[model samples]
Target: MTTTEIAPAPAAAPARAAHLYQLDLYRVITFALVILMHVLGATTFPQDVVSDALETPLHLTREAFFALTTFVLVFSYRSRPPRPMAFWRRRVPLVAVPYVVWSVLYWGYSLLTAEQPVGSVAAALRALGIEIANGTAWYHLYFLLVTLQVYLLFPVLMKLVRTLERRPWLVLGISGAVQIAVTCFLSYPPEGVEYSTVSRFFTTLLPYQFYSVLGAVAAVHFEAVQAWVRRHRWFVAGGLVVTLAVAETGYFVSVHNGLWPELASDAFRPYLVPWCVAAIAGLFLVGTRWAEAGRRGGRVVSWAVDRSFAIFLTHPLALALLRPLIAFVGDGVGAPWTTVVVYPATVALTLVIVEVLRRLPWSKALTGRPPLELKRAAATAAA
Candidate 1:
């Protein structure tokens, strides 16, 4: 009599997953920053005093891109069924073809221009198998190699992350501790710790691997991060401001006072941890809430997002065309403002070129396709 028939309260509608457009816009913005960093990095601005002052933020910008890459990869792969072989098959061609093409281009250029006895074709082949001493383009290829390593390890890492996500505070505490330890260890080197390629690889790869794994783990608890970001946007902003201020202050104090030579030279590394966190938080906030706020962002964002992969692949050739101008402009003119102008110009020009090439008859193969016509023919034959 007290309760006629107490019905259970209806479950709340499942929270709608955020739109992909938001992530897409974030990707475009981050990639544009990556392009800017590369363009400026290739110039001489980083070594100058005023430029160094400006370049701290730019350095953060680039590391933020790398951090975003790790973050996005985690988000993209989480809960997606594992496809290890498919992953390799897709990424290998994307990475290997461009790498080989660029390697040869650089090798040929070196042979034509260098003063020393350059390696023969046979030697070049051997070097490529084990090392890439003469391949300037190989600098960027290292990330591809590292990304492949991360992909290979992802399934195992994902399992661990799933287990950890249930106790997010525990996961964060452990990861943060490990990251701090690694950073501290890296901050100081023993006398015999040579700075050769092998040593450098081990040092850099170890820390980067930790961050990448942390990113994968974080993906599992992204909802928690999203919630925190929403509630503490100002706190996040304050964290960023504090991080940048400390970084900039350290840079100037070191440059002027000539204290902590190693620390000063390696200021970029300290900023990495803070900047990565801030960028991820910033992107999450914008992506979840503000992605569609601006009118100009809609079509432009869509275009940039669609073209990002292709543009990343082909933009180096465009940069090569501009290298002569960059060289002529000299170190004096390679300021942040110069880069602010040139980097976007280069990206725009590259996008235009790629668009034009897409319209050509044989453009498909050059751009990693068999051709639209060939695809149709294959479909018909299969049917």
Candidate 2:
């Protein structure tokens, strides 16, 4: 008798479920920072010492959000087998729906308010090239487009990273070198060549590709990094202090030397290296320590985390509504603490609005699901 041995089935893929509490807190903090950055961008404070000091923190804030995006995306999806259809189902609507809606809304507003002639549909089509000229909208939406590309490439990227998981330091070295090379190239601003849309997309995204790939690598070796952070918390903290000081000094020197004109245009790529690394280190150090803190005072963080995404999508609208109030405070009629008061108030108001919207019937598609209502309905069905 000949006996044939059968190989056991490959182990089932890990569940995709993520801890809501942890993600929600991250979302809250990052989205709040996004809104605060936008608010700062809109306002024109006196260019004095106080304004410079206040603006420094805001400069670092949104970089934290970008780095957090990489961190969360990597961790949440690392174990799950790739499902391109499912991935697009979740991400595309979240991004494209908002993009289309906001684009039309802003376009209509511009038509109504601006002195430029409202053109025919054909003329508007022609002007599509220049639609982004004003820079009022999140010029940063290009990042979302880059993120979509990264998601599409995740499976291949993840496989490659997993193969090198045993040599994480090598992966880090390669990624860091690529990132520095890309930054150096981008910093030299191409001369005499008109940047086409395709060129522009590649130019903007090349830097972030490094982070996204590094993040996947980091995910496979997360335990190692977490341990390192815990063991070297002070070192990580010192690195952050030094990085921030250098970035601020760079900003001042650029301003003094009239390089502000060159740097004023927001190019996300170059800044990603230093600012993002600092933000990631700081966040990792904090997260590891917080996890070790045994869940005490976790609720506050959880609340912020839960409301983060909705706030990100809806806070622009909220800020538009609050613009007049912001102007009122900044106009010197209010107390010296106007900025301090208005900033927190803006976040609280946006959170309240997001919470309310998350419960509405029409809003469910946008805000994921209504947790309490769904739970009650399920209970009723069971009963």
Candidate 3:
């Protein structure tokens, strides 16, 4: 989720310069949430497993993590102020490089194994083109693309943020309206209309603007937000749960009644804006409390947090290779048990591989972690 390189806070603001453990905790938890959602999806068996009823809610709730990631990005950008070009110079390479590398890797894998559906080289190239265009090189890469869009607009966004810094509620209201409108468009696209690649890029970020704006608002008033979080922790928690319940119930009833069946199960709908916003707020507060509770379980959390981006990139490949094993376990075990076993096993195995990659030479370009040797080599070269 830490996609970009942030400039350090100025020396005069040492207090603000220190790392925010709550945000770190948020990153780690969001990573798990995303992984869990994907695991549940990929580990499904052919049988009557958990009902669509349960899956709908889980999917809806999990999307809050997407907002969590965006929140981290804009939050970092605001705290670590840099010129527009300087920001892009440092930030874009970290993500853009990995995106291209992973895209090529996945595409080549598909070509060599004939895994993807493409009849000819032209078809394969076309598919890759679309994938890159839409930033769908992998299921997770779409985040980086949408983030890139947000980053490109960060200057403009900051202008708005500054203009409305004194009026955060107003900012939130505007963001909520934009998010709702965008979600509605996504959930119910006009009939007989086909979206182009360029449109896809813009549409992808439209629904997420609210979260970025919210994060910007939080950044401008970090102390105030944290203080508010501490004072109203219970209220935030209740709002999160209530909104989630309402949103899930709305989906459940819609699906059951066969009303808007196509949009009923979708997470990106107007109804989820409140739920996702509340969930992000509540999670941030809860994460702050967990971080304050001391360094217990710190190593494991740190390990997971450090390798989270790598895990996101490589996990789908791990799942693909392990599908047979996953299916075997499911067939041997029962419905829910299979999900339990697959989730941890997938995470553990993926982390092990990512750890190995972390130690290898030139792995940073792929995994986003600059290994010790690479850092030393760079230092030596610079000297």
Candidate 4:
């Protein structure tokens, strides 16, 4: 489903001294959307047209997160190149430990919640092994495994970025076309098509190779990219509105034409590619505008950004714990609209979980962050 290609080599351009507050805004906003998507998926009536449409658009957040990770990476590494070994030693554990930790955490939860008992300990252990390899310990945990792949390949990706400095759009054009082809295949797989499971293809960057390169290439072109996004902000806004309507219309039409609800709402379809592009542009613009307008989020956004990893890791737990209490309230709103009540409650509880985890000694291993330093907090307060 993916085509991996490299651009020709050339010397790199020096990175500009761009402010990062915009990316901070961009990343954290996308993180919030991930939570919302999860809550909706867990709570909403899947067959409902309205709810199903929402899922299609929201699925872009996963790709957006991948782009942002590489965007930040390319910019940083370009500014200050990394020794591959040191970069891996430092970065891999950050994602790997949390990934393993949460995979076990969720796998265990699934076991305990299952109505049918596991026949034996060996079977359970084997299941866990398969779950981790398949990245199905939890649906969302695949992002971590895929991201770990991104981090591992970033050195190579960064070199690719440098090589394409002389022909920025060439790399983007190649990646974008590859992505479209991939989407087309996913949307219309050949009859009797099969995907590998033991080493699931989706758990790698193959499914999202375009997005992996998108962020990196964007970072390579950050100064120009930022200037262009900021300049065409209104265009970005208009494109988002237009693309969203088209995506929705296409989904309804597909359903009317006898497509299954699953295919009609599958986020990987070509109908939403432009929609995803526009939404990403709009998100980047808003983040950039916030930064340009004095970056007022201050501690609140920073705090949220700080805990986002933990929230990403543990929000399902928070949601699970709160479901019994919220499930009844959802009945009043009706299942199709249940997300209205459930999403906020899940977010609040997730925050509480993140706060508790932040206080632990091994916070970084569990949460991808260390304990907040009093001096830094004091400084933020003072500033």
Model 4 worst lDDT window (10 residues): 1-10
For model 3, state the Cα shift of residue 16 in Å. Answer: 7.5
Evaluated at residue 354, the lDDT of candidate 2 is: 73
Off by over 4 Å in 2: 1-13, 16-24, 45-67, 109-117, 121-137, 193-199, 202-204, 261-272, 333-338, 368-383
lDDT of 3 by residue, 232-265 (tens): 9989989978987887777767767765543475
Error of model 4, residue 340, in angstroms: 1.4
lDDT of 2 at 342: 66
Estimate the lDDT of model 2: 0.57
Tell me, by TM-score, which candidate is best: 4
After TM-score superposition, the amount by which residue 54's alpha carbon in candidate 3 deviates from its true location, in angstroms, is 3.6
Highest lDDT against the true fold, candidate:
4
Ranking by lDDT: 4, 3, 1, 2
Report, for all candidates in order, the number of backbone clashes: 0, 3, 0, 0
Q: Which pairs, if any, clash in model 3?
A: none
lDDT of 4 by residue, 1-383 (tens): 10111132237634443447777788888988888888877887667677787887887898888888887788767766788999999999999998988899898898888889767989999999988887889888988989988888888876775666787678878888988887777777767776443235667787688876778877777767877987898899999999999898889899899887656888687888888878888888988788777778656887778778898999989888877856787767676557777888888899888877877888888898997677775675576
Question: lDDT values of the candidates?
Answer: 0.58, 0.57, 0.69, 0.79
lDDT of 2 by residue, 107-183 (tens): 56556656877879887655544443322344444444555556566556656756656777787788778877766
> Model 2: how far is 151 from its true place, Å?
2.0
The parts of candidate 1 lying over 4 Å away from their true place are: 1-19, 61-70, 73-77, 90-92, 109-117, 132-136, 197-199, 202-205, 257-268, 292-296, 331-337, 356-383
Better of 1 and 4 by TM-score: 4
Please rank every candidate by TM-score, starting with the best.
4, 3, 2, 1
